[model samples]
Target: MAASLLQSSSLSLLLVVLVAAASTARAQLQYGFYNTTCPGVEDLVRTELLAKFAADVTLPAGLLRLHFHDCFGAGCDATLLLKSHNGTAQRDADPNSTVRGYEAIEAVKATVEAACPLVVSCADIMAMAARDAVNFTQGPAYQVETGRRDGNVSRKEDALRFLPPADGNVTVLTHYFAVQNLTMKDMVVLSAAHTLGVAHCPSFSARLYNYTGAGDQDPSLDADYAKNLTAVCGGPSNVASVQPLDAVSPTTFDLGYYQSVATHRALLGSDAALLNDSLTAAYVQFMTNASSVDTFFADFAVSMINMGRIGVRTGTDGEIRATCQVYVD
Candidate 1:
């Protein structure tokens, strides 16, 4: 009888230990994680963004784009913030050369750091700043998960390898998003972000001067729209200036981008490629109309939250950098 009782006790204890370990892991990431440590982290981020975003309506778009770029290269690890140890920072990658909003992140980071010394991670700050930017731009507001940590490494090669190129076709873009465990629909939904940002002239010049290197415009592009793009965009070699992806409502987060894409007015070939596929084309048609604006916003929110989870580091896996722009020396 005593032997059986001892065996039962051991089983109970093992169960208890396993449950405790699970709880500890859960603590690594949860909503209201900083309710005690930094009660005002979200508000601080929003306030800082309001000031910056209000002054420059375009700021939110770039900030949101920056957040996505970070997630793509390293699962929202804040690797993009790592300063170049030797020209290796992800932010300096060619695809990311035009990414903006570092100063905006600094403004919010300063506020969070003031109240909660080492309690908040820069990765979380970035996630929240991105959410606030979207909300500030009249996009859908969504809750972002926190407790991510700053990664120690940042390589330009990773960014180049992971980011979907402006000239990528539907198949290439689909594969890239799939690698992140994101579906083709997620790729189409997130493309709604193009509603607010701009593309460099070099990114889409191929559709103008040389769709196939014969100095002929891409037939896929609407001829009238191509002419308009040619006028606004610089030469194939010109990287100095950028043109808005959605000129109709450049600063607004609406369905105008999908409308632009549906008509072959999208700034990047990747954007134009959406129309080449039946599935993606359906999304473009549905989102372009006013009735689907709310749906698009809601879909964008879900995808953004999903994107924020890519390759996240939490639970003592990485350090919380004192400054967001570099690994701790």
Candidate 2:
């Protein structure tokens, strides 16, 4: 009788443990997920990014965009790091062609693995790397939730459809963000990441050379600003060259991005589109002319937290990748 009683208690306890784990995996991520599992994960990612960013200031922006690409593709599952044998990885997408800092991610995976063999997920590493990238660039130090799992599926077509286009308008951009369960405010705040990166000519050349097939420039672009862009991008050998997304403070992370947009100097049509809608327009204006960086920083952090939670796989759904670029055997 005692043996049977003890067996029943053991089964009940096992069931309770399973339920708790499921709740953790499906529910919200926490801030201290690694305190016991791998205490040095965040610090390792931070140190790596700091050294990398010092050598290449552009790295922070690259990793920031990398994070966006990762999340948008498969719910922050680190699918962006996958390497397909067919050469059709998420990074191969046209929109992500210029994204840098993959090496930094790989380095982080190696460092994290050395300390904690298989406890940390690549998804969490990606989240921390992105957070470190942003904070290292004079941006806010936001708390990143951990406990995300690494995803296995990454398709080239998925990225082409999901990644926001440079030419998207207010309506198109709004719909895209909405599909991801993000607000227009989140879209605007995230757009501020453009302050640090460069765009290839193909991204904005349509506005400069041919808005329509008949050879007309986009009327929305400031005439003088258009002229300056043409000078920089119109050269015979410059069509393929790169231009800073934020001409004001190209390397600094600040409100200058909104200021540029407010002044008709934004390079991407989607950026300029924020001024077309009443709600987004107010955000752009306030962010542009507002003296305090506190609100923007706070909003950005909140939005990032929200963005990081999209469609994540926890519990036993996805596996912890042995490397950021490949699945485990």
List the candidates' TM-scores in order.
Answer: 0.91, 0.89
What number of backbone clashes does candidate 1 have, counting pairs of residues 3 or more apart or in separate chains? Answer: 1
* Model 1 lDDT, full chain set: 0.85
What C-alpha RMSD separates each model from the true structure? 3.6, 5.4
The prediction achieving the highest TM-score against the true structure is 1
- For 141-191, candidate 2 gives per-residue lDDT tens digits of 988999899888888887888888888987888788888899877898889
Clashes of each: 1, 0
In model 2, the Cα lDDT at residue 238 comes to 59
Candidate 1 residues 1-329, lDDT tens each?
A: 99999999999999999999986675456777788988978887888789888899889888888889999998788888887856777987898888998877876777778888888888888889888888887888889889888888888899999999998888999999999999999999998789897888888898899988899988988888787777776567877777889866888888889988987788889999999999999999988788998889889988988888888887868777667886433
lDDT, each prediction: 0.85, 0.84
